[model samples]
Target: MNSFNEEISSKLGLIRNTLSETGASAVRLRGTDWFAWATAGASNAVLLAAETGVAEVVVTAQAAWILTDEIEAERLQDEELPGTEDSANPLYKLYINLWADSAARESFIRDVTAGGKILSDRPTGDEAPLPSSLVKQKRVLIPCELERYRQVGRLASEAMTEVLSNAQPTWTEYQLAGASAQALWSRGLHPALTLVAGERRLPLYRHATPKEEPLGRAAMLVFCARGYGLYANLTRFVFFGSSQANAEIRNYASGHRHIREIEAEALNFCLPDKPLNGVYDVLDRAYHQHGYPQAIRQHHQGGTTGYLSREIIVNPSSSQTLAENMAIAWNPSLPGAKIEDTFIILKDGRLENLTFDPKWPSVKVEGRDRPVPLEID
Candidate 1:
């Protein structure tokens, strides 16, 4: 920790000293290779600068604005503007996500713009992957990183518990969203997908935005909490009235559990050395194992979620190998319900549920039926 702090301090001092110098105009920071492709790709350079697809989706347009303005200003005679609205949607979504918070707005700009600007000055159009294909040097996991994630996950579940306890039937969907966001913010985590599906809202639109209406009888409150470029995704449903169904609902939830097992089975054979494609191969069996024979049509199950919400999608054709220590969330929804949790693949080849709280309800995984809550109490 001290070493990291010293390194940062030294870098800061250098920046401060250099910025005041007349020779500093030529003292541009050599940027990270992460955005090299997008920088060289020029026109859509801004999108590449984002930390996540969601970030890119939200900032792409503004980035384009910056790029075009720089070009017009003769700041970069060689650079071309790389603007794609579809690509910018996530980045734009991130901006609106700040929800009028000035600090959030400033942080968003810093996280997305700093690196790209440095590379943009020297404009290239490579459009390379964020991590680059420097032939992955080796399979490695940072010890401190794993421990830090454990703490973050614990904090996330605790926040969820505290906020969920205070929730009331009369609270509006927007208010509930605020509750979750506040909890996350207090813990130094940013709320990514603070989506709430109130009452039967899930059946109507899977992308149900928070509204002013009361939670009615239930709510599907889910979010992607992030810090240090990593995320802990979780979903919790709350119920006010009797959440029991005749028999069909029971059967459906049971089937969902079965689906999760299928996902588990696929990951069983996954090894750190294997490429993503092999992990892709297991998802089919998991789908079939879960009883969704035609799983492709239902919903998109997430892929490796660490640096990106989805490092890659694991649809039938993808052959991306599962990397160890990689965190993932597989949410397969049916009707008015969904199942999700953030988990890390342990070195022992078992998945350690990072976001699972003792108070949070659980279903059966392995042999024992754990305390997984299917309905909001």
Candidate 2:
């Protein structure tokens, strides 16, 4: 069986238990990330933007059905549907999932359950609080998903590194962001968020989107690139001219050191089974311990990242527990400095930094390798 199919089947099998317990005969998924997991990477276009005419239906005791419009019907059948060599072939069925409300749902009930009584968990339906039992399972990465994350992370880092390394003092914030986006698109990666901050805008704004401000002495480039329905969240800095141009550069350097120390404290606290609030507590304490107790509050400290830039953010009162195989992107920032990178937790409870690129210059603080401020002459 193809590994993708295996992943889908395995997920469906687990979902069946949730179905049984809730007395739900089937679950319909419309969210992009949920759809991607259900199809085992067949529906990655949902990552770039939302589109109509596609849905995934998984029954308690049956295989998954990939419903699409007539436009994609021929292509999917010809290319995506399994052939004779596939062992999990019987576990998947393709049908058009979109139609006018009543008729569409009726057809789905008939095709999906073969006339069985059903309770559907529609995310947009009257369901309150949005049922998560069926989709939360995706928080844990499987082997096939990890492979895609690795490749996408590498591509994203390469693109960001290329754009920031060649930065110039005359480049406007908009120009830098545009170049970063172009670089990512050239390699099939889509920018979910492209933020740029030049020397004039330093540290004042946390989410400094691209502006026309010229990159005078230094700048920061932040990007959340998506590929294969997975995301890589990263941040880098570039300094123009000499490092001693002014006191601002030196302060930025000092801020970088302080934030890295805070990041290390937070990351080292990210042990498996640790509560997210505890991690936040570590961040809060680190900021205070490092003389910037209020730095973390200036901007949101990032949390788990995977299909979305942040699956969920970590807040002071968050209760979510960290788990092995969970992808995380922690961003701890001060006024003029910030550190963010995508990483995944291994089965042994070790965090693997996915956004690290040897081609980019980095510094070692407290024995931990951190991306150094790029100096461009």
Best by lDDT: 2
How does each model score on lDDT?
A: 0.53, 0.77
lDDT of 2 by residue, 1-377 (tens): 66765777777777777767666556666556666666665552533655322545444465566666656666666654543124545666766634344477556656656554454434443332224654466788888899999998999999988998777899999999999989999998878789999998986899998898798898999989887678899999988877787788989999898888889888888878999999888999899998876777788999998877788899978888888889999999998899988989887867788888888888876565779788876
- Model 2 TM-score is 0.89
TM-score of each: 0.63, 0.89
Return the lDDT, model 1, position 47. Answer: 31
Which residues of candidate 1, in runs, are more than 4 Å off?
Answer: 1-140, 245-252, 266-270, 278-281, 288-291, 367-371, 374-377
User: Top TM-score: which candidate number?
Assistant: 2
